[model samples]
Target: MDPSTLFAVAPTFPMDDVRIRDRSRETMLRSPLTWLPLLGAGAMGFALDAGVAGFVLLLGATVALVSRYWKKRRPAVDAASLRELIGESNAAQDQELKRIIGSLESKGLPQYSLCLGRFLFLKQKIEKDVHRGQHFAVFAQEVEKGVDGICAEVCREITGIRAREERLGEILTSRQPTQLERLESARRESHAAILHAYTSLYQVHAEILGLGSDPTERETVEDPGELPGQRLQEILGGLRDEADMIARTHARIRRTIEECPPAVEAPRPEVVC
Candidate 1:
């Protein structure tokens, strides 16, 4: 399977951190504006009491000192503080998050990405109660790397699903074909359901990455031709029992479904075949 088709969800470039406030360059532009106000106060001070001029001068000096100090000081941060800020989460899952973080830190990753300016963004997602029970590992890395890693894993699983589904369809066609009409109907239905489920997940994953609504055309989606009823479970069970393919697929699908918002309807086609 082409990895490109698999994660049409991810961005083409590494997503730089989201900027909640203006950049230093923007702040520099405001320097003239700041001076205008200072000049107004200076003029007003001259027109009024000399005391007012002294007060304005003092205020301007204080502002300059504070701004300089703020720009020069490095924000305090460390792994322990991060853990404390993340505070707590589901015991098992939280431990997993922390473990992953520890591993990344050992590999020389930062506890925060203030330079990128999304440290607060990531921190809120981790520390807030609203995001509890949801996966946060993606935020730990840059958007491109995180999504690419996830897509790679899911692409492998999808390759297996497509392979197994095709194999199952071929077996049914070579043997049963359409002789047992009732059985054939059932096989087609089951296979269709599987395809439908996969399609919804495919679209959902893409939607999460802010790709405009899933552009998957209904006619283009893979159809399962036919799959035996009793044998359907056998195929799924075999793919599952023989290895970790189905389990991984299930996990990936569940993760996407869980992350998507409620109003985002699953994109299932209404084909009877």
Candidate 2:
């Protein structure tokens, strides 16, 4: 059996002092080896005076059991507190994304491009933080939730950009009669490319939601075959490649939008007819 398959749930996050203490307390409770020395000492006490020693052993055992139960409760409380903190952090991150995206949208083209570049930088930072935190099983769900929310918001924004571009195209079709004839052909190709990009973004969002490992679409084999060595390398390199590819694509689309000229807002015609 695979080592990973053996564990029901993977671990998550950096273990803190509180977690260390709680783990140590639980270790003592679960292992009978912990009481071997105690039992041996109690036996020695018994040899000295059977009745008095028996009573002492009984008292000690009872104390140990009671102490174990008390220590157990504190760990539970610690776990609950950590979960609440994770929940709060996730909420804060959602608000942060909203603020950043809104500010970017409010800016002029050059400024918006710079802001988007910064957003991508910050987004990469958050993703790394979440991955590091994922090593501790206690916080994995929270990390996943935060990451998914970020990805979904990005996809929604991409869809919005596509819709905006379509509206701009329609206005151009009606207003710039002469220019439209020349540009309309090129516009169709550009629209198709943008739609394809939007589709990819939507798929990435779905994969994240499903907790699926990210995979890149490698070059299709002409003969419908893959070299064994290449296949192995792909399996090994998939996760990092998928993440990098996704980030690059998103960054490119953002930069394109930033560089695009603002649509010429057509003046409303006066009632002449």
lDDT of 2 by residue, 1-273 (tens): 112111122122333556556555665556564565566657666766658757676658766765666566766646655655544544554454455445545543344335334444444444444334233243344434433433444433444444444555655745545444434433444444434433443343333332323223333331236532333233223422433444455555555444545556767789987
Query: In model 2, what are the clashing residue pairs, if there are any?
Result: 11-135, 11-136, 11-137, 12-135, 12-136, 12-137, 13-135, 13-136
RMSD of candidates 1 onward, in order: 22.1, 14.5
Scored against the true structure, residue 266 in model 2 reaches a CA lDDT of 68
Off by over 4 Å in 2: 1-59, 62-233
Please give the lDDT score at residue 248 for candidate 2.
55
Clashing pairs in 1: none
Q: Write the per-residue lDDT of candidate 1 for residues 1-273, one digit (tens) a residue.
A: 423213233322332222212333344445664466566666666766659558667667756865665455313223223333224322332343344434434434342112112322332332342222223333323322322333333333433334334444434444433323433343344334344434433332332332222335422432445321222223323322322333344555445433433332345799998
- Residue-pair clashes per candidate: 0, 8
User: Cα lDDT of model 2 overall?
Assistant: 0.45
Off by over 4 Å in 1: 1-5, 8-63, 72-152, 174-273
Worst 10 residues of 2 by lDDT: 1-10
The lDDT of model 1 is: 0.37
Q: Evaluated with TM-score, which candidate comes out highest? A: 2
Best by lDDT: 2
Stretch of 10 with least lDDT, candidate 1: 111-120
